[model samples]
Target: MATPRTRGAARAAAALAAGVLAVSLTACGGDDDGGDEDKSGGTGGTGTTVTLPRLDGESLEVAAVWTGTEQANFKKVLAEFEKRTGAKVTFVPAQDPIINFLGSKIAGGAPPDVAMLPQPGAIKQAVERNWAKPLGAGAQAELAKNYSPGWQDIGKVDGKQYGVYYKAANKSLIWYNTQVFENAGAAEPKTWDELLTTARTVYDSGVTPFSVGGADGWTLTDWFENVYLSQAGPEKYDQLAKHEIKWTDPSVKEALTTLAEIWGKKDYVAGGASGALQTEFPASVTQTFTGGDQPKAGMVYEGDFVQVNIGETKAKVGTDAKVFPFPAVGDAPPVVSGGDAAVILRDSEAAQALATFLASPDAARVQAKLGGYLSPNKSVPDSAYPNEVQREMAKALIDAGDDFRFDMSDQAPQAFGGTPGKGEWKALQDFLKNPEDVAGTQAKLEADAAAAYGN
Candidate 1:
């Protein structure tokens, strides 16, 4: 379906196009120097620019949950930082699970100089426990002025900034095959009822309407968060985030009921409940676009990162797949989930330099060039995006305004959070197995969350 681009997306596109034109002109003209002059190391009294100090003689280590494609992109940025500054970054890429590695390190009192925490709960915990240092007023002001409002708030703990944000992966998007929707004579649904009707119409046409994977447990949590915000609004969501509301609240129940109803539909989701339970997130995401059908599934509700996994297949972004905001249900504003903020441990000079560089628009442009994500920086143009899908996602993010919230699973405490082998993950798996027991499922979750929060 040809969903009309929202005003925010249109504005972002215009900004991006203008930025791209300027960049092209500058590139052609060989204007190599363009950055914050005050911040950029320029000529000094000694007729030599003061370079960022090397980490070779410095005692500092960095740890993070970055691996695979993300690691490569991170390394590329870090390498540039190291060269610009004389710092030797000893990056310990932990493929051996993030929490386990960091838990041990933090306990030993020898934590790394920087840690790229993908989970908001981990970032919050780190701040609460005094495991990291605040970025201070100066850094916070720079970030607020440079990045998106959503990103600026992500790093705030007790109204103080604790991290410097860089890349963001928007999750409140629904990706669909454009051709399939067009052929089905379907338009992107604007309201929850419209969405359901559209899904039913698409399903009645013999194609699966949605491809959701609940088997990973984390995926189910996504549904919960989406519905919660849609039903209760962002204010209530914020209350939930701050532990002011109970998980067993009526609003939470209503959201769970909506998920159960959606999941209960025959062929509403590909592979059924069993399929959703056993499949990994990426595999589940790929299921929506698999095979030679003109358009396999109508939509796949997932994060912006889904484009990265889909890129490995025969379908290319934009042509084969495009994204729209997960339509608002009732009076709720459109919301999207994603991760934000990159935290520096404050001990290493190199790490601080790296953080400063990343907070700049230059680093944001670099992230866009690498693909598979969007920068939280509003000033960075989307024209730097390599593909149309990335461009679309970036535009959606900028348009989301204050309605954008991080994934609930990531926002909760570690115990309630769906980390591997956690109770939250286990409960989701159990709930999916028996979709009839909605109350039982919620009770289990409420108990778990209360225990975790000491409520």
Candidate 2:
């Protein structure tokens, strides 16, 4: 989601873009399975690698919401960039709420050479405000070589490319404790009905079937978006995000009602609705692993970034943790995804060089090797990741092709999509708390949508 600090703040952005939030790695443990050198780079449709000009005597500062292992991993990539070009690059951690900080920096005429924005809306906003610069030739060449058309489209505003998505997260995943599933004799659900049946089986096994992170409302939005995408399809999803359709539309009601089958089920969800309404994202993961006073939550739905939060728990990933793509509700399962879209805010040779470097398969390969970093660059290989789970998730994301949808709320305005206690987040919260009031929730949602989008 956008500008999420791991800041897990995708909820705070009102997150995400959840990539306005983070990725599909670490859901399984990092195995350091240093098998063979990845050969997926330098192929496919883009066919041209953008090579940046060597910077033997220059320095640049870049900003992103990364720290700890994530920061170190990116730094390793940057270090390689520095080594290859002799440019000294300084990595600055963006503030918890990055938009305001970035705006202030721009106003002061000191924006970083490049800023990694996780939210698609944020990138679009920057393009609209004329704060972003179009990609230079080197960057454009890399985009042509490495990224898919859909990803290329994500960074565009009015046909001008102003951003590059270096990192990605598959938001269409459900992470579960393996032991819980094995105990319930549950297999991964391929269809929504199957999912509900599995939930019942899991509940019958004396475990909470799902962990709803109602406290962090974005998680709830993810629940709604996935169902909406599969139920209503991508064209409608984009139309709604752009305010081409009202939230009160029947399709929305259908999606929300479908959600109620699970949300409304008592004990099917860990801690019940009230308890979930208070559990933030971190607690959602911890509780799934910990189970607190109840049997463990059999499954928790989140992007691959959930792996980091899972790391905070005692359970081992891959061995103890497992994941499945979010099940299909309609004719097709939805491939909803998001990532950190890096946009150049200041136009300079240094900025252009950094942007170009970031767009290349080489730069992506460096971080992909470290785990938790998924690249939209089509050429990057499955083996670039450290583990099989991540490798598979990466492949699924790529295979979804142009049919993929970025996180819905993340593609809308922050006031409508990313704020706290306002707009979609609050409306979805009300729905979670009172699933029987479907019509009432629809009205509230539309009213909020109108206010936020000024429709």
Best by TM-score: 2
TM of each candidate vs. truth: 0.81, 0.85
Q: What lDDT does the true structure give each of the candidates?
A: 0.64, 0.77
Clashing pairs in 1: 54-86, 55-87, 55-88, 171-337, 172-336, 172-337, 215-276, 215-277
Number of the top candidate by lDDT?
2
**Model 2 root mean square deviation, Cα atoms:** 7.4
Worst 10 residues of 1 by lDDT: 24-33
Error of 1 at 107 (Å): 3.7
Q: Model 2: runs farther than 4 Å from truth?
A: 1-29, 32-34, 39-51, 54-57, 67-69, 95-97, 290-295
